[model samples]
Target: MSEADSSTEAAPRGGIRVGAQKFGTALSNMVMPNIGAFIAWGLLTALFIESGWLTGIFSGLKDPGGWVAKIGGWGEYDGAGIVGPMITFLLPILIGYTGGRMIHGNRGAVVGAIATVGVITGSDVPMFLGAMIIGPLGGWLMKKLDGLWEGKIRPGFEMLVDNFSVGILGLLLAILGFFGVGPLVSTFTRAAGNAVDFLVNHDVLPLTSILIEPAKVLFLNNAINHGVLTPLGTAQAAETGKSILFLLETNPGPGLGILLAYTFFGTGNARASAPGAALIQFFGGIHEIYFPYVLMKPRLILAAILGGMTGIFINVLFSSGLRAPAAPGSIIAIYAQTPSDDFLGVTLSVVGATAVSLVVATFLLKIDHSEEMPDLAAATAGMEAMKGKKSSVSSMLTGPDHSRGPITDIVFACDAGMGSSAMGASVLRRKIKKAGFDDVTVVNQAISNLEDTHDLIVTHTDLTARARQSTPSAIHISVDDFMSSPRYDEIVDLLGKTNSAEGASGSPSDGADPTSDSATAAPPAGAVATAPSPTQQALAVESIVLHGTATTRDDAIDEAGRLLVECGAVEESYVASMHEREKSVATFMGNGLAIPHGTNEAKSAIRRTGLSFVRYDEPIDWKGKPAEFVVGIAGAGKDHLTLLNTIAKVFLDADEVERLRAAQTAEEVRDILTEE
Candidate 1:
């Protein structure tokens, strides 16, 4: 296989399996918006049928009246049939609504109706599966309208835009039902019946079973892109009657994929798009929908093709002749559309085809081994290294590493950038002012993006992998309890060591700008200031050392919780509630730390939690049992997301894992952190 093919080879629910949600969403998107379009189509088809437009169009076009007679497959002795009605009525509306939801997140009822109307009025060309373009356009229209109203659309209207409602929604639906989808659906129902009867015929031929899937994928794409859409547009005109689609016998999608899997892999991703293709062609006769699967995983193309040829072989051998197009040999619609009672033959061919396709696709996946995907962290960490990560906690925990910046910059940054970093800036700023050294200035940026203007930068941890990309030679400091931890020590020492050297080496002639460095020129206005150590001291650092390590993670959390409760910082129920809630989803914020907290806490329980730090020797599942340490807190809600902000202050900025790996003792850790 080609390298691209090897890598692109590509969730299971239940019997539902992978791609079920995608398919279901697609179907829903197609069906819902088209409700109104269906009504319009039904109305038009009813009018045209009664008016004899089909007869005129067919006669003028030299196509047989029989084709027109079967537009909806519902012809009476003197009346036009249901086939015409269904074509005019149902498909567009149903498909449009479903399409809207799939493409657009949520929708309003009025919006959905307007979209359905647009489809009813505009659909003339085929789209995704050689079906209607109206469905997609309608969705697009609703999405556009929604964007214009954005926040203006109230919750009630937001629900109405894409959802079902009773008054206006029901009325619109009723109109569609009476005049659109009902008629077209009824007529399509007839066509489906006839198609089933035709497919039920034919003798037993084994090879036909094998050819179904590939034939469906390849030919299905060919049919929808060229065959079905040709006569409708100039873009399509060039390909008209040029392919096997003219035969009207092929399923036009990965019908062959099914057969190959059954014959080869038995159960694999090959079946992913089969269910959709079967339903579409069986009842709707729209193909090409399965192209995404093959486009996504090109390796399966040949396998699908092999299955198609095999299906044809088996069908021919069995003398199985389907009167109407059958997407999959497996679907009953194919059987229903057949002309023969050799129903047994059609059934066998379909089942065998699917089994074959499954086997083939499954085998391909096994051989490729490209299906396994990596987790997000590994992928993102590589990305982080490229982007340059800064340590937020370091600057906040200690003073900054800058000699050219002011403390307020650090403070503003704490509110908008990193609170801990800003706090450090504040400490450093006050210290500078108190010491009569009004020359040092502190700057704050995302720990992920620290600036070089500051004489010093401080952080408790080294986001070096993330920050190193942009932060070459910038001073850095490590601190304790960035949000509430001292692991950011690397930041403290590094910035401390480098700040002075960088400042001296800076050019006074670098630029006239206040923050600019010019080795031969003057420092910027309000630039230099001595950050106060007492201010850093004033910001209490509650270092909860191991105090003697615990055995497990939960026990550690329990101990931490006990300490927090003892400090009168939080209610005991908070811990239990958080644990119960966390079971549904994980709360292990990695780095061997389990930050189990909540969005809402009892007003009485909220407080500026001094600190609840516990250590563990053996990790237990904080949430997933992958735990080594945990810090629990309950900062007062009156402070507005205080606990959340506090948590963010520490963990978001520091490389806690690396720091813990280096930290040996609580006091050493504390001294290392608080000393700055």
Candidate 2:
């Protein structure tokens, strides 16, 4: 979910909270998904509009004193001839399609586009704001009309009614857009443009940061940009070929400075994650990446506010503006949008803001470290205790009733169902395969499209309410971190146990038993007596560390090896051998776990098949992947496969991973590791 969804509340804030939420969601729906389209259009406008680079190139080519004057000067190139139609026609239809899709799916998108054309034709301006207002309005009306006649229409005439209803709705909305909404929105747009112009001219524009910075932290940046600033900026840009309003919100300098401060001062994971965020925010044009960092340390917002105000002050002082909107807010995009004369001024503003923000944030961070900082181990343990309490409460309320039957399908849901959710689902799917639960199917979907048919649903805590609303019957699991949810382990364990119970009954089930084929295989003489259960061979309480802290992958492997050595499981030289095996292929697996084992030559060091488990409070990057659990295995031969399979089963389960991560004691880790 975007920051906006989390911050928005039903209660009014400054009398605009609810309206801002709805408007912001709709506007962002139109623009955020189509950033590529906006970038293409912005780049085109930057190249071909009045006083643009392409226009300059054409003018230079047609200069009378130039060498090729014999071919005649091609005076007054018509750059607008290519750009004018896009703004008037194509932009509105895109907005309309997005707005309509938000309200009523594909059919609404079609009618929304059709209605937006009317707004475009009726207004001299680009009519972007008009498209936003009317497109959703048309989709909503079409949806209501469809609902009204959905079951009332005769069966034989269903197609006829559907077609005619859509046709009539499109016709009515188009006419209404042209005659009603278009003129009214145009007047409001002009008035808003005038007000912005007055503010810019009077040098009061820098104060917008007071509102913009706070709203941005709340994830309202997209709404402010696409809804309020872009329309006004477009109007001003049309007149002067640039607008300072474009710089008001898309400046990345403030965020860059804050991230830089965090890189220097933040503790543990915050410090580790900040540098990547800075690179992505400054170069990738994703300003939203920094919102969570500020949210985590709210006091840092003062730095952002000061930085934003400083940037605006510099911009206004230098009369700097961009020829078009910078969609991603990256430095590159901002420079591309900047006019030639304003490049130096824009650069100075960004640099000045970065400098101011960095100084202020560094001071704040340093002064804010008042208390004796808690160790990463203790902090993570405390968090796990809290999570345990919440889980216990949820368990008590629901009680132990497996009547929901075995879960055949699992869905990982999020706001967009694209990024975090998709990754979470992928991790679980691989885990299921590794655990030999081939019958289970895992997929990801947007919360809005979550279906009741799903047997289990996993989503972030913030999204649990929506997930429940969509699929209340499905067992709902909410996690604070999708990347490292321990609940997946529980699901895998539950399925494994259920399969065991069914196999014991000696009755064939719909799904194949993963262990059945292997269980029935005959063993050679004395093999059965010598073979040990995975738990007995691999795990011991002494080999487990619930709060291990390793700064790197090699450190983690070494720590795990030392544990096994202390338990008389491996020779001292085995650590180096494990490092060699890792070089051959890093054992870092998904779902926050890694298995580090020695190469085949190191078998001489192994006295028995033994495993050492180390859980880090602060995760280390194990070859580019965050690893919280490192399990080191020492095996003489094929005896380690049983232990590997057991560990895979535990790690693959999301719930089990959570349990292990949140385990408060070595006993808890041992129980979770060996229970199966």
Best-matching candidate per lDDT: 2
Q: Local distance difference test, per candidate?
A: 0.39, 0.69
Query: How much lDDT does candidate 2 score?
Result: 0.69
Over 59-136, each residue of candidate 2 has an lDDT whose tens digit, in order, gives 656545432222221234432354566666777788888888777767688889888988877777778889888888
Please give each candidate's TM-score: 0.29, 0.57
Which of the numbered candidates is closest to the native, going by highest TM-score?
Answer: 2
lDDT (C-alpha) at residue 68 in model 1: 57
Positional deviation of 109 in candidate 2, in angstroms? Answer: 1.6
Candidate 1 versus truth, CA RMSD in Å, comes to 22.3
What's model 2's TM-score? 0.57
Off by over 4 Å in 1: 1-83, 103-132, 149-304, 313-333, 336-676
